[model samples]
Target: MRSGPYKIIIGLALWLITPVETFAQSILRDAETEAFLHESSDPIFRAAGLTPQSVHMYLLHENSINAFVTGGQNIFIHSGLILAADDVTEFLGVMAHETCHIACGHRLRRGEAYANAGTASILSMVLGAAAILAGGTDAGMGIMMAGQSVAQGQFLAYTRGQESEADLAGAKYLETVGINGEGMIRFFDKLRDQEILAQVRQDPYVRSHPLNRVRILQLQQAVETSPSYQKPPNPALEEKFQRLKAKLMGYLYEPRRTLRKYPPSDTSIAARYARVYAYHKSLEWDLALTEAKALVESEPQNPYFYEIMGQILFENGRVRESLPVFKQAVDLGPREPLIATAYGQAMVSLEDPDLMEKAIPILEDATRQDSGNTFAWFNLAKAYAWSGRDAEASLATAERFYSAGVPMMAVMHAQRAMESFKMGTSEWLRAQDILYVSQEAAEKLEKQRRRQERQRRLSFED
Candidate 1:
């Protein structure tokens, strides 16, 4: 199943009942959507005096309206928030706020407090060690609750202060970039009503950010006072935003809902995009093909239209037919890592020796451009294995596993890679690095197991 451009691998039974933490296990990794997010956030990041490329954006598979900055330069945004946003500016406003948290070193300061309270080490252990060992057991729940209690109690006030600071800082960034700060105010205003709801019913953003009427008023005042308050929205940007939202709706929502929202009466490109996804999801391949071909005809130069068509054809068991479409997308968007990755993936899927050889360099280049791309690494591994490059294939598998946070598997593949490579070579050294990290992860897991066991024994005695 898919949700708003993200593939959901968990079974429907598990997916329906899974908690938020379990949902975090899935990640959405579309190249085009990620690229668009980066572009939208670049101005805000730059205005905050941070390099645009320094912070990485991750779209979580969950459907909660929230975005958060963690211990590192990673920003996680839920696809629900994206779909919920009214416009590009509204979404960008959220990005600006998260970037403010990172730029202001709020996470670092909080970490320092955690360290002072002797919770930092255990917190890290909870994420890596306890998570690996306990899975969803009571021990795991206790550990997580302990960490959250400490974090919430010790830093709640500080975090609220930071939220206000981020709001002001984000408005300043939008102003500096000539974007209307009203969008930020408007988004917050929309959430203001959520403050009155029960805690469990409130959106995650409301719960995390601590929204209030006073804050909304202050934000509105600040935005109205900004010189760029009346600036018009960029037409091109708005178009991209519309297309992205449509694409996501088509992929994520139920086919019936999608078709209802974008009926046959709606002939706009965005409407067509949604219908194509709906048709594809409904297994109406003929209708999907017709809509996709129409999209291609309407926007011959748009790489995304071709990309979507290629994806539909490829997924529907038309490998040979999909190749030319994917190539066209790559040719149109040469610098696009996602398009290149898709082309390479298609080639690797062909299982032809010559095609696999051709795919390797493309996959390699795509991975080089975006090292965080799991799809590229996985396909690159397939390409390598097909060409009988066992050592390289093992290394690529290790990379894929490492990126997916499966350090044990990563270590296994790294060990295999080491056996295939000569001593003192670059590949051997890289394998050694993977082995070292994975071993550290293993040790952490063991520590967490011992800690949980001791706790369980103590409880039993009591």
Candidate 2:
């Protein structure tokens, strides 16, 4: 309470901000995976005195072994990192560490360092030029090299300090949550081998996280000395972790590879869940349907199984069948926005007047539940359009584009929506707000583009 916590922005830009080094990974959405991540990380967030909802976590379809927090409370995790984790504990360890970075204000501190680093680099070039004028070319080059070395040293030293701080803080959070730091240390051990590899070959996690031998040893010693380290593992949690990994493996790997790993002989729940996707992806519709049916039969109450069945059936041209399956999923997990969005989308695809009318309320509820979901917003726009609410559709489209960071498109739609609504009305005001915000964002992007263009021209001249 003593700390002044800035308001967390809930929108597309924050959720899908630039990756670590402008991470190019695409954002992946899944209802089940998101639920799993929140369930695992919520306790750690609470223990760290942070609200789980205030901190948004996004899954990236990235193969690099990385997880990083950016734009304050946003954490982007790579799929490779999850698959690389041997178990849930290891994955949670990374989550705790990233959360600790937010708790400790590392992002703000790092931002300060970056600003200073740029100034130092520019100052060094000037000093280097002065040396060249006073002495010779060699002397100037040497001055520049030394200056850069000092600048780089300062940044790396500060980063290492923060990394060490987060490591200890993460360990404390784990202990507070009654989870042992053994998994934390084990994950570190897994990455320790990367130290021997050449820098270019190192995983993004190792590169960005910067794990020195001393820090690793200190972390290991601290975790081992803590009483929580002796705590027994949770079998139920481990089972969930296994299934989470299995699902990722099925989705990430080739169908051939997944089938090989979870062959016909394998009848475990994990294998069954994985083969459902593998068979679906590999175009073996019958096998996929069979596996999905088996899963639903085994866990009649599980909403996710119904979701998968609905998706498989819908994608395979069994639209009517999928409608009921998707509806079942919604009935079971009514609060799940993504599932509801899917059901709404399926209803829209049918183009039936009755179905479209029904979809309007469902899509509206989905968007109301999670306004940041672009998919839901898009579906809602379609439903609104079908219901002869063209202005509402335009407003919804504006909202969708705004949340997707497409400011120009948002501005265009917002303006159109504004034209249709009377002044002083809520819809008109909202349209005006969207138009203003999106126009500003669009202008900012244009300015950046111009600046980058100027830089390129200068580089060409040099």
Candidate 3:
């Protein structure tokens, strides 16, 4: 009920948007994200004493070189760390660390502490972020809580004595997995070096995790004592992992630098990775297509490889071509919300309004799958808008935009719906009521707009 400027904007953004029914069906399904979760058949899962429910690894798009555990069921790894690793062993090392956290029940303790402290507000934020990381629906609810309640002190509690516990646990897991703890040491060393150069002083991981010289020293000692701490010869899987890492780096790095680091070679898949980025960065659509085509040909079964091709084609505005590639990806592996969302977007962009009948249910599935997928909501909003169901469309668009962190777009959609209600039929008035807007404000805005338009034309002529 507050009349402050910010409150007004929030109110409009939350409730009053025009019904753009066409934008409702564009979210990525849970099946998609579920497919992308990390799984391994290594005996270490059991050897490390990890219950199946205790260790669920997720791949997040965050570029920061960090990995964290939110609770017993969720271990979040940043994509940047995966891309930065020299081999699968190093990647596994990070997993081992997070796994240690779960095995030690640190995350579970944090949750218990927060609840017992009556810090429901801070716990709400953590739960929200955790939900998105776990690929769950209602992720936006988490974001809303995060915005209202996140505090450095509360987050610091997640780090207390937990880092050392994970380091030791990871070292032990490496032993059971027949992996050298040295790999873990190597990855931690890299992170330590990064911390010194970071202008921000606190890397996202370091801020949340209490990494220190003592922690590093302790890990080194663990590796030194661990039996046969030797680097394993890179396996076939390592090569596949490299290709995946390179492809990701290609997207993140400048083309020239990527090419220099990953020179063209017949045997090296990194070259293809570099080329994909090069062509894309250079805006050479045809060349990018050629590179992507070659990549898909060589790695036919890798869904991630297809994702690269689909991304290239999509960025180049070849929506039709992009659609099939994304579809191929979905067929290859349907659990990634990103792929499904992209596929749904392509379907909507193809100009078949009837196709939305197909897309809406898919997006609903996606939202139910993981409510944090803002892009899916965005595509759904467009679908709804074009379908002439303005009320639902506006709400969907507003919510999608809000989830995407685009407050302006959210406010615009809300305002559009409010205006439509004022100008259109009694149906518009009915819809406005549903949107939670007052008749007095709606009439005032309409009157203000009419006066402004009159002034705009007169000023233009003058």
What is the C-alpha local distance difference test score of each model?
0.72, 0.73, 0.58
Between candidates 1 and 2, the lDDT winner: 2
| TM-score for all models, in order of appearance | 0.85, 0.84, 0.64
Shift in Å, residue 155, candidate 3: 5.9
What is the C-alpha lDDT profile of model 2 across 59-135, one tens digit per residue? 76677687876435667688888889887778888888888888998843345445655543444445544433432
Question: Per-residue alpha-carbon lDDT of model 1 for 1-462, expressed as tens digits?
Answer: 223433321111011111124222344556567678887888889999998876767565456687776534557677788888888788888888888888998843345545544443356434633432422122222233334333232332236678888998999999899898777777888888898898778776776677777777777788889898877677778777887788778777899999999998998888998898888778898898888889999989988788878887787888789899989988998887878887887788889999999999889998787664556788899889888899999999887766555568879999999999999999999888878876775576567667878878988999
Q: How close to the true structure is residue 45 of candidate 1, measured as C-alpha lDDT?
A: 92
lDDT of 3 by residue, 1-462 (tens): 112321211110011111122221111122312332344314445666866644555454446676666534455556677777877777777778777666677753355435533344454455545444444323323232332223222343456477788888878887776777777777777777655655365555655665678998888888788774885834755665776576556655677877777766543566776677666766777876787778788879866667767767776777677777877876786666556676777688776978776777667666555455666777777777777877667766655654543334555666676565555676455334433322232343355457668878988999
Q: Candidate 1: which pairs clash?
A: 4-252
- Residue 247 of model 2, lDDT score: 82
Off by over 4 Å in 1: 1-25, 108-158, 453-462
